[model samples]
Target: MKKHIKTINGVDYLGHNALANNKIIHIKTTPSSSGKTHFYWNKGRAELIVGSKVHFPVPSIAHLERYRESFFDVGRNEIQIGDSIVWFFGKPIQPMVCATVVGARRDKGKRFLRLQPNHPDSIVPETWALYQPGNFFLVSNNRINRHRAPANIIYAAYQDELNKIEEIYAPIRTRRIILRYLTNGNLSMGEKAFKECHYELFKSIYSWAGQYRKIELVIGDRQFPTMHPSKVEKAMREFCQDFSNRYLRLVGNDRAKMLNALVYAHKELAWIHPFEDGNGRTMRLYLELVAKTRGYGFDLAASLNSKKKKRYYHFAVRKAVEGFPRILTALLNKALT
Candidate 1:
């Protein structure tokens, strides 16, 4: 054998080995400190080097890359709260499950992640687990079957929308613009501001970004029903009128009453599901602008990808689709600052 090279997780390492013979070899054990096992071909035999130790001739190079992407040395700082991850079971890597990273901490210099199963039926030993390289992987490149989009793609879309919001709608100016229409009782102007959020966020991706959905819309795996295509315009008009009346009536000293009105408007607009896509994103942005007009912070628009927020949002949106606003109202109460 001459010089051997290996690549793992986009990093390459080189090693020189002279076996004076020629036969292919492989190994099937835990990788060394370098996270890769080197193969040195010789005459009818090969060397299997794991760390400073060597095991004899074994398997094949095809199996070397089997779990290559699974053993990334993710830094503790790289893992953020509310990130999605997947954990593998025992040997052979079967029975893998998806989970959300809810918390993080260090105990005695060892990092740990607080995980919650994405599926309620999933069985996990503990909420906290050691941050080991081979035990779990972030869900960035994994393709979701339902939307057929990678998790990283979904996160990128959210980040793009957030960046646009900050660019086009600075908080003070956004608050001024929204309150102008609200205080003047100009529902048309308010609706334009509402739809503009969708246009600004998705005009490049969807031609119909600012328009109402012309086709029937369904939400989530449960197939939550949105308003019929024919009724969307009328529903939105009625919603705007109702929201205008309530906002004017409740914009006084009672912050609690104002929050209730804002929550009601949010749930009603979600029920309408005006746009073909990005209803949730648009609604949250619109809600934030409205909240800013009332002296509340734009918290919901920024953290839409949070796992806990996703859980709460799905539950609240389900109730909204079913024409029940209580759950969504409660969710908004918690979200609005």
Candidate 2:
């Protein structure tokens, strides 16, 4: 009697939720030749036999309708196995195809659905599409392949990408020699030194280590565009020239001038965002090396602990390059030993 729930041929079929062991639970009517109808819950896709005749017929239009309503609606948190999805590629003229959600995986707070196309000629069956909000719509669920399901299939598959990045950084935190190798290099402040720092730290994990990012990059909630790849080299060269001229000369004594140059250097490099990854780590290492060049210790971690500090730093990184480095100067002053 519900919108999608229906009883057909003496068996009650509910939508979606009654699924387990790849079978829909259906309530059957027990035949006793009596006026009273006795209820029985049956679990199977096949017909139920009461008196040598079929009680639950093979899937009808009502069953098909129930399957249609079981798909994951856009923006819904709970994604179930066999939920239908339709991927519309680009413009309206492009072919829209139907795929069944065979698996769901999470990376960095976003859900990705591993889909199997209904037809072999459609989109690649092995594709994992990102399930972003407003990107998908409901289609018919797969009722045919219900027999081949694996045991104990849970819907939410979460693999945090940050955890993988932390795994790469774990050894550097625990070991002193690794830290020494990173910070003790006598490389002069230049583009080569910056690339080398990125390489030495992340070459073990990333193939693109020390390489400038070819693709476009946007940072944080504001989606601030870092320097385009075409302009990265030019920006880095200019920053290095300024760093060598102004910041390097003031390294030992003039704390006021040195800090001002340091703030500019930090702001410029962060805006450039040269490498695809490890830019933050590389910048921190560069700052520490700058401190060491003058026989002083600068612990950048001291100023980066609080949420408010991080929020302001994120704002300053973008704003400082556009205007003045006032907030960044205040933040960097805290890092001085």
The alpha-carbon deviation from the true structure for residue 108 of candidate 2, after best TM-score superposition, in angstroms, is 36
Cα-based lDDT for every prediction: 0.55, 0.54
Q: Which regions of candidate 1 deviate over 4 angstroms? A: 1-139, 143-189, 301-305, 321-323
What's the TM-score of each model vs. the native?
0.51, 0.50
Model 2 lDDT per residue over 1-337, tens place? 2212343442212233323332333222222335323222233433222223334432321231112221223334434435455554343332343455544445688766666554444434456777754556543333223232111111111112222333334346424333564576665667776777677666543567778888778876577888899998887888898898877876667677667767877888888999876677777777766665666556766565676776777777677878778877887887765
**Candidate 1 minimal-lDDT segment of 10 residues:** 10-19
TM-score of candidate 1 against the unseen true structure:
0.51
Q: Model 1, 191-309: lDDT tens per residue?
A: 77788877766653455668998899877677778789999988888888778786736666676776777777777887888987778767776877676655676576433556587
